[model samples]
Structures are given as structure tokens and as C-alpha cells.
Target: MNISRRALCGAAVLAATDLLSFHVLATPSAPKIRVGILKFGTVNWELDTIKHHKFDLANGIDVEIVYFAGEDASNVAMLAGDLDIIVSDWLWVSRQRSQGADLTLAPYSTAVGAIMVKDDASIRAIPDLAGKKIGVTGGSLDKSWLLIQGLARRDHKMDLTRESEIVFGAPPLLSEKAVSGELDAVLNFWHFCARLEANGFRRLVGADDAAKALGASGPVSALGYVFHDKWANENPNVTMGFLQASGAAKKLLAQSDAEWQRLAPIVRAEGRELEVLRDRYRQGIPDRPIAEEEKDAAKLYAILAELGGEKLVGGAPQMAPGTFWALKT
Candidate 1:
């Protein structure tokens, strides 16, 4: 992470490429690492930075980005061999691994939701949410809300579904409703949470806090770079080099405010919203060692499994082994 700027920024920035630009930076003979990503994914910021610095070529690989309009399509492309890598949660990776697919994950983000609300003395904690209307997305599939339920059950002896009104809607709509005072509290995606924070809504309890309270040793990375273990074993240099490139890009993004300037148009936010978004993204970067992540993930998986049953964790009693992929040192 402390790699020198001289090393990463030596190459002239290349023009942005939507589909494939491996040839732009790498020699024709270099290895091509095909990546599937959502068309509007935040992952593009890092990929753009990687291209700007020519990190992939410098690290001995070429990156070909294949954009999909939906996450499901991106995931399908990975399994169908149309992609070498895709961004997804480790739980999905675990499910695949259990079903005899050798998928693995490299930690990407721990960003989740929070109970956001206006300053009101009556709403101090989970108990205070009793009889209050809570706006949430993903209905029963909202992991942050599920974790909050686990936290409330463990700490406050309350069932959020029974005590509070759970209003399920799309994130933007739920956020809009929360602002109008119709919803007492809202739990939405992290970016929406950042916008809400910028607009003066405070965090009551974040998913990370709930995770910690539920026995996770550290923050759990809910999303990661997923790929097949077999392919990585066959292509060690590309695998390790890409991971290094990713780390370098994250380092640049974390330290350089100037870097965010070029990123602003893609971020499409102005003023406080932009600042808050940047800060929140910085907070979500994965810093823990893989052992800690795996340990914490196993713990959280059990919690989710107990609360959500087979639907949440598939049929596996424990997180399938090799859920977290580490570059062999």
C-alpha cells in the first residue's frame, strides 16, 4: 500500500475504454485478465485508476473489462467463462464452492447500511424503534436489516419485525419517504446512507456495529473480487499482479484528494454529497488480514444462517472452505 508514486504513475494515462483495452497498455504477448463488472459499478473508479497508471501492464497483465447492466448477468458471465473475475459477496462464492464450483473471493468492501434518522430524543436505540415505521430495501433479503435484527434480539430482546413497522421499497423511494418524515428510520445502501448523512440524517447503528455485537471479530467484507481457484492456480502471476494493482489503486484513491477531482464526473455528486461519498468509500476499504476476515466471516455466516436459514446460506452448515482466496506467497 505504501508503494512509491514514481512506480505506479510512470505511464501516461490511457483513454478510457468501455469494453476491452488490454492492447492499449499491454504488449500483444501479455496475459489478458477478463473482468466482468456492472455497467455503473463503483469498481469502475478503481479500474479507471488502474488504466490511468497502467498498473495492469506494469504488473505483467492486461485487463479486459466486460460491463453488464445487471449484477446477475455479470455473475453469469463469470461462470460461463466469459470472464475471469467478477465482484460479488463471499456468501455467493461459498454457495458456489459448496455446490462443487471452485469459486473464491478477494476482499473488496465492508460497506453496509445504518439506521438513519433525524435528531429525536425518543429514538435513541433499538428499543426506541418500537412502534416506529422503518423504511428498508430488499425486503427480507436486506442483510443489514437482518443483522440489525440479530443485534436487537441479542442486545435488546426485541424482534424488529414484531415491534416496528417494516416498510419495504426501493432505496431511492425509501430514502425520499424517510426525508418526508413518513418513515421514522431508514436502512438503505451505503451510498444512499452517505447522501442521507450529508443531508443531516445521523447514523443510529451501522451494520458493522451490529456485526461486532453479534460476535464477529472485525468488520466483515460483504463484497469481493470473485474468481475460480483453479484458474488462479494456473495463472499465478496475473492473479497476484492484479491484486497488487488493485491495492495500489486503492492506496492512490485513499491518499490523493486530487485523484478524486478526475473521479468527480463519474461519481456524479457535488459539494457535501461528493465529500461524504468519498469519505464513506474510504472507510469501507478492506484493511484486515485474510485470516481475520475469514474468521469473522465464518462467525457472521453462522449468525445469518441461524436467522435466515437455508435461504440465506444455502444448505451448508458452515461457510464452505476456500471462500476467501489469498494469493499464495
Candidate 2:
């Protein structure tokens, strides 16, 4: 109890330093969220914006964006644990979950795509696409194609794959083929479809209408941010933080047309291409999802179930419950 003043001062300084160390350990840098994206994919624009704006950092997540040549490459990398998340459709998530992948889907963009036909082509409606040479992006498992087939079966009672000459090609190649009259019509992704429309190609049925054509009640999730359920459960903060960052990005894009100009260069869109891209991005921003028991959710589920039945989703019967993670809620 008779310590010298110098010794007392040293002890106080040591205690303060230890407390500072504890604070540093308690609050380390944000957790890194490794995300996979395809080169030239539309998701790239939002993600790149997130990086430039530091939205992920603001939301307490360190986001690392990884690029893949295609979805196949991304899928392989994700399964190998190199990726924490990827942008994909709900049906794809369901199919993967059905196969026991334990994946969860968060609404990314509802921008389902569209079919583009010539301004003067005989094609006028969905059924008009029958017996015509149609170009499709992705492979036989493309969601747009599968949805179209489902529409054909439900409305015209025809199997489009059997009726139409379906040709699978890359999005750019498909666009070229359609413009050069090599294909009568081309089913393209949202951004590509927008460009084709801007270039004077007629917009036929878009995926939203395609969903209506197949009897969906309300808005359906066309594409989403997908992650492993186990990983998400283990790192709840990272998952929630990611969704918050994404929501902020979506809000910015949804509200500001001027913001589209900022992303145009990154997406390589210009002139009419830029306008189309802006419109599609705005249109694809989805409302917060409702409960699974809601009528709209049920109807959306049914549409996907039929599309899945057509093998668009690797032959899953229906979307397994818990496939959709309403993290925003």
C-alpha cells in the first residue's frame, strides 16, 4: 500500500494498454465475403459499384469479387468452396438444394429475360414462335427457354422444343444471329434483350409476361444471390451484412437514373444500349419478398415447379422450403 508515484503511474499505463488490446481483438476488420460472378454478367455492374462505393465495407462485410468465364465455371468454383455466393435463379437454387447442396437464394434481380424478333418478322406472339428457328442463350437448361416451353404447353398445348428449331448459343452470338436473319427469333437475357429491343428488334414475351403466361400470381424471383445454408448459418452477420449492402446498392440503382450513367462504362453500355440497360435494371429490382404461405408466393412457387418439371431446374419437383432466405426481413 506504500508504492512509489512512478510505479503507480506505470501500472496504470499497463492496464490502459491491455484494455486497448482487448478492444482491437473484439472488433477486427470485417469478415471477407468471397463472391463469384461471371465475366460480362449484369451482376458485375452492381458488384463493381458496391466495390467502388464501399457499400459492403459500410455494411460491415469485406467483399471479394471473383470472376468466372461462365456460370459453369462459377458453379464448379462455388462447389469447391472458392466462392461464398453467386448470382443465379431461384429454380437453379431449388434444383441444387434438391440434389442436397444446402443452398439458399436471396433475391438478386427479378429481371427475367425476353424474346426478341425482327421488326417485320411474322412472329407476333408466343405461339407465333412455333416452327421458327429460334436462338437461345445458355444450354438446354436455360430458364427462359424452359419457361417458354412451359408457356407453350399451358397456353397452346404444344411442346416448343419439338415444334420450334431451338438453337443454343452465347448471348452475343445469338444477338448476331437474330440480327443477320440466321435465326427467326432469339431468346436473350435481360440486358441483351434490352439491347436487341433498342436496336429495333421487337420485344415479344418477357419473362415477367412469360410467368403470367404460365399463371404466376405476382412477382417471381427471376435471379438471386445464392449461398450455402451451412455457411450462412455459421456466419450470420456476414450473410446479413451482405444482404444489407446489396439492398443499399439496389436502392441506389432503383432510385437514381443518373446512377445508371455511372455504371454504363463498366457494363460497356452506350447510347441506346445504356438506356435499355437502365430500364432493365430498374425493372428487375424486386419488392421485399412475402411469406411463403402468401398467395403470391404460392403462385410463384407453382410456376417454378412446372418449369422445374420441364427440367429447367435439373428435374426438381418443386422448390424445397428454406431454399429462399428472406434475409432482408
* Candidate number with greatest lDDT: 1
lDDT of 2 by residue, 1-329 (tens): 33332332222211122211221111357788899998778888888767766777776778898888878889888878889999876666766777888887666666877888888888888788778998888777676677777777887888878889999988899999888899999888878888888887978877678766666666666777889888877776787667766766666776677778888788788888788878878777766333421334446556656555555555555567667664321
Could you give me the TM-score of model 2 versus the true structure?
A: 0.83
Worst 10 residues of 1 by lDDT: 8-17
Model 1 C-alpha lDDT per residue in residues 1-329, reported as the tens digit of each score: 23221232221111122223343445779898998888877889889888787878867888888889988898888888789999998778998999999899878778888999986536888899999999987678667888999999988899999999999998889999988999999998888899999997889999999999889888778888889988987786788778767876777777778888888888777788888888998888777766687889999888888888888878997999888875442
State in Å the error of residue 91, model 2: 2.3
Error of 1 at 229 (Å): 0.6
